[model samples]
Target chain A: MNPSLHFRPLRPAVAADGATTLDLLITVRSPEHPPMQLKERPGLNLALVIDRSGSMAGSKLSHARKAARFLAGELTERDRLAIVTFDEEVNVLVPSQPVRDPLLFISAINTIHSGGCTALFDGWLAGATQVANQLDPAGLNRVLLLSDGQANEGLTDAEAIAAKVEGLTQRGISTSAFGLGSGFDEDLMGAMAAAGDGTLAQIESPKQLADLYASELQGLASTVGRKVSIGIRAKHGAELVDLLNDLPLTSAGNHQLPNLRYGQELSVGVRLQLPAWMPNQEIASVRLAWDSPDQEGRKTLIEQLTLPVKPEAELEGLEVDPEVAEQLALLRANRERRLAIEELDRGDLRAAMASIEAIDQRLKGLPQSDAITRERRLLAEKKELMTQDRNLSRKRLRRESLRSSLNVWESGDDNV
Target chain B: MADSLSLSTAASLGSDSLYGLEELLALAGERLGEEVTPRTVRLYATEGLIDRPGKDRRRAVYGQRHLLQLLLIRALARRGLSLTAIAPLVTCSDEELGQQLLQLEEPSPSAEQQEALSYLQSLQGERSLSSSPGSSASLLPLLGSPLSSSSASLSPQRSLSTRSAGRSNVASSRWHRFSLAPGVELHLSESASIPPAGKRREAWLARLLERLREQLESES
Candidate 1:
């Protein structure tokens, strides 16, 4: 199924004699959701990389084990899974195999006990190898690295880890990360997922691990596109100002979008500062590419945005598309949310509050939608939480930040 | 007339935001919550910690920039970082210095704690040892496995709704974060009930001092 893609410029016609800048919103509408898509799922070659460390002694380890067992039970003979657990040492406990018997998977999951220090890099590498070993082109292959971003022993550098994950993603293997509880740096975990073309989530408790796993298993089953990306190249000397997804940019200056879902409405906002161009000129070219989930090979969709340049008077008379305006508001809000979260992390409550209040004040001017209203209300709630308890506020805010930035949650309220 | 606005606000604003030395002292005292004497301000300037205050009509005037720079000098100094170490970090624009002050506020994890938070995360659902069925796949050749393809799942149409997620803050533990490297940290724990910078902060350093204990870890 092909996704419908289009571009909407904030100003349909750029001001030829006025401001030379334009805001373009590229939206890819996925094929509509078919309910029957639930019953049949692509074969999954997945790795569940578990961390059985000393620190994860209580709820963290227990919840993770239960989640692993539950996830193993969910798969069928058609699906293949590999389990790799690590502490000071990395162990491939369950090699990649078909989920034929529940008792065998259960016995393996039950043997997982807390061990020593963290060898995060080596452990993840082990899990990735498992998936890569049993890689199937027609199936979804992923490594769910359960870690807390603490890599003491092996490769502790985040950038290097992210680069490795990205390389593996390019080789048809994706990795997702889940760090149990709050206050842990989601940035590192989130960065890996974003780099690996997968999902990153902050699990609040060991118990939430099972729920998160169930939802993610369902999400994986419904995966329609792998390594979905939007490549926007400038045309006619137009400069790309910003792409507002807060995603890690590729060396070629593009974004790795979340895997496309059935009926995926991927709306990405890009700002373009146009140079002198006549009416009816191509300002930018957008290329959407994804690997077909069921062995259909790599697919690419290209669309050239040819916006008409108008004189200042004509441009002034043009109305902004409501869709473009709405996209601009949400993306702008997302940016402010990031700034606010950064301030909170830096231990500046007043500044964080001030930023949220200032943005909430700014949002009053935009054409308000239910989404914008919720964004303002949520920011206010975060501020309220800060005043009550700084610790709780920080954790809650980080989770909210993850949800907003990634938009990867399968169900339930945004707060979870 | 140009001096009516508060010094720090002026410094954060434009050139029109200048103030007298006394006004700078007062705000610094309030920010640092300690006596910020003119002598100390002058000492900072003499030591080249802050930019030399501008002279408006030969009466030494200061801006918000001077104040932030002053606070940063004191902040870095309080961190026990020598002037040389502080020099490279403080060499930025007023805006960047402001951000740096905010970043410097939080303390880094100590070496021992850093070791604890150092993470090796990957999820393995199976135990291969003493398990014959699952481990047999490890012995199987990779290329020989059948590669059968299937379809993806059906998803519900979704949007960012104002749904309040009810959380269970039970089994709460003091989460620890350790510095793996610069621009990266490993935060273990569900809750980090850190004291507000107010009670323990050095007036101006209050924002950055909250991490002083956290810094106690990484610095150690």
Candidate 2:
């Protein structure tokens, strides 16, 4: 029994006669400082995988270099940097060096020139190796790979590269892939990020690359916790239906409990459906269990929480507070709505319009009036954008570009 | 008088005499494959569709007449008319009821009903029953299936008389009227019937009533 144990029950803001019943139990623990005294200045290992193929000679290369310089400036004295530029073959420009030497890093990023076919995989693998070697079990290890063209060289298979990076994620290194221009493989970059336990985003033009990099770097600085896991054991006839932590249900994998460092805070969202009961019958115990590192080498159970279900009518006027659950639901809904809009802009007019309609209806029912208004406006704008044939290319570009930026922001927030 | 006495005695000797109020209500609902709340019992009493026996405030008793009235009320309520609207039609003479119903339906007759009516009228013209006001009776037998016969005698005169009485009572009692949507009129009314099995009877009664109204309107 932790002294800081607090329980919150969630109820819908307004209860209608036929409204669906949603019950949630959220336990907030008092902030506990990590037992171990970790380093105050964490290391940052960034691998800038740039494309130097023949198509990138003019504005593309200029924008790429400028973006690289912007990213270099974001690194602090505690950070380490590496620059890997690729064309037909990969080249290690700066290798793995400390960001303390800003001038050297910027110059190295600027010297890269363009020539032959793009070998995006080679650049990513080279960058991964550099970061993996400099991995401080305590520091944030990341790779930022950018490309203007598709991979057309050795080990060009996107799936194989994603699988390789997925293996790297197991070793605690995360990669963020940025696709530049419309011709590049969006799926390949996205899969790479997914496998690397990071994210993939599309940059329609080189101009947006710097701001994107700066934002990604800022996200790295706010990292509080990583690899967070939550386990729940429901009462008989009850099961955990979903768990969303700022993302939708992508794929189900094995549960991994990672250690939490000092100054890190992680939030987990859970949803459960309990068996229907007769009036006045007590709901059986629902247990929530989680594991985090203690002072010793072994992981300790942080808290085991429980909640009881009572009839909705009887619980009238009692403030139902399921903040975690509500946050999770809101986040999931937002992601789904965003994905639907993306599909719509891709020339799949029917699906896109349908998605907007669903999102519009959902927004109308949301408790947050502000969110509803904002979402409604966005849906309307997207619908208008969909109707104009001339605007198709621009709309597609805008949609992908905005999606990437949003994904980075979300991923950064999740790490916080 | 002797025949009336035997009829009353036989009804009393039947299951009505053996059951308590709660058991009777339960039986009513069970017979109709529904669940009747206490409110439904009160509603039937308020409408005079069910007779409450005596000054025994603690345990009110009801009889077979109550059941019959409930069955009739259920039947009329199913024809897309509100209880208030059905009340007058239920107690009117067949001729009067036919005229009133025809007036109500002519404004916005549904496509299906119009088609059925046209078919029936065309058939009537061939048989030369076209000019008679009483020609509705000819349509009744054609329209009445076995299901409808069990619920209520499709004789328009009987339905009209009952509906007229019900209408006056409804007006005097200030009971609210609930209307059902077009095709759903009969189904919902029967479902919400008071004596429970009233719902099933209501369904059959609805078809017969609809056919009668349609036939009368075509003749007019």
Candidate 3:
């Protein structure tokens, strides 16, 4: 269960003066070729919760059904699948059962049609219950909720629903949200997915839904760690200024992170104000905790980072790490882009442009990579496209920003 | 050409010569024969086919540049030009734009074609109402289809050329001096400006400036 957890301060050393502030990056990397070493991988017990409201009447329903059928075809006989669809009333079309016959699941999925009001929370609860009933400690137990956002029928508040989702995550049944389109409340869906320790996919169309589903299933199959979270324990004199990732924080103050997929790096930026250092004292430590696959308890990895105390003269000569700078730039880009979208919505174009301009300034001297170049292109493209249509622009900006920050960005962009 | 131009278009191109949406539409209707509507004009502006109207005292208004661009787009659309095909025209100079518009007579759209255009327009209206971001329709360059590519052909080089003018050399003659402590002063060039991106960057810059101040104090 050993994974790489690293803490890298931008500057290798800290000045002894209490006035010196340090910026750092925390990275948790998943093993790239783990399934190759293991004899067997855990099967997925997934609950597919779909919204069949009246709003999903025409092409939306047709494409959703097609996506669902395609997903059913992707599952193996080792996996357990349950189909719980909802309108004003929730119905369990396929009970929790083994995928001995993909045909049966697809047939059941095809029979789904549009109905009345959206009972989103109820539908999700029904799906989470299905996974919990046949809970497998060794397997991946998850609820995949596909919705078009409005949950008018029952328990509609986002904060309340996220709380319930986190409760399910605690019981080893994580929930991921697949928001259908522009109508999908990005903040709500993103919040729920973050709380549940799963992926939040902003599906712009029914066609992309199938591909996103396939990728998500691929992620589930190759997940290295589940219930992954980071704990920040600041040493007595040190102060944690800010965490740049827009992550969900637990009541205990741990940052809930996405479940680790092979080759995925979950990195976040932080700034710390350390008091006068004495010798090589450890100022702060970051610990990673995830569900242990080998045993009943949890797996833990600790990385204590302390800068080499040096005089002010020596500290001034040190250069910032490029990796840390890039991460910081990416993090700043994610946050500012979202703020710029909000500024656009408020009809303040200059402020929106300035918000993005700030990010461009931040990227001025950073070493260029595919990642950095991608950030530059995204910032420019979003600024250009943000004025086209308010609803669509806002939706795309939020989703892309969220996706970029989470490192789940795919090149299959629907660029105009 | 000035006499042929719609709405007493003055030869002098001052920035103050502005037109409202209604005025642009009225002028466009005179030139293009009523094919231009407020929605379409706004759509074209948003799609980057025309320069976005600037705000003058809280009311969005367009300049002569926007007027010329709108007329060019309306004429081309009347000539059965697809928006993606016409994207390059956005970068044309005023002389070239006027020349191009003068050569292509507005093809009289047939009743069937008019019906088709209006139907497509109504469909666009409906889709934008229930707009899904990143759809194929969003990718199309023609019409008011959320032309992400329309922006591609229009904005990047245009904004860059203007930006590159100042970016190449940030030189300013004026500088200001402020005292940090006894016998220590800080000087800043006028062009050394930073936008209020966020508090974090500002705080970081302030810290670095603080270091500069300390260094100066130690030197003194």
lDDT of 2 by residue, B1-220 (tens): 5445544543663424534467656766664446666787677667654455422334555544444444444433432223443333234333443333332222354443344334334433433332222332333332233232333423334444344334322211211111121111121111232322356556766765686576546545
Give a tens-digit lDDT track for model 3, residues A1-416.
Answer: 36788888889887786566889888888877775457666888898999887667778889989988888888887788888888766777766666766876776777777765667877887677666656677778889999985776545679977876776677677888888867778777877887777877877777798888888888887787888778888895888998887776766778877788778788878889887787778878888988744346778899888778998778878987888888887887777678887888789988987888788777866888888887777677766766665666676667666753343424276643
* TM-score for the A-chain in each candidate structure: 0.90, 0.72, 0.93
Lowest summed lDDT over 10 consecutive residues: which window, candidate 3 chain B? B138-147
User: Which candidate, 1 or 3, would have the higher lDDT against the true structure?
Assistant: 3
Off by over 4 Å in 1: A34-39, A387-392, A395-407, A414-416, B1-220
List candidate 2 segments past 4 Å from native. A1-9, A12-39, A154-159, A199-201, A244-269, A276-301, A312-329, A335-348, A387-407, A410-416, B1-220
DockQ (C-alpha) of model 1? Answer: 0.01
Model 2 Cα lDDT, one tens digit per residue, A91-146: 77765656664765675666666655676766777787667645555567778888
- Give all TM-scores, in the order shown: 0.62, 0.51, 0.63
Residue B114, model 3, lDDT: 48
Clashing pairs in 3: A416-B148, A416-B149, B83-B142
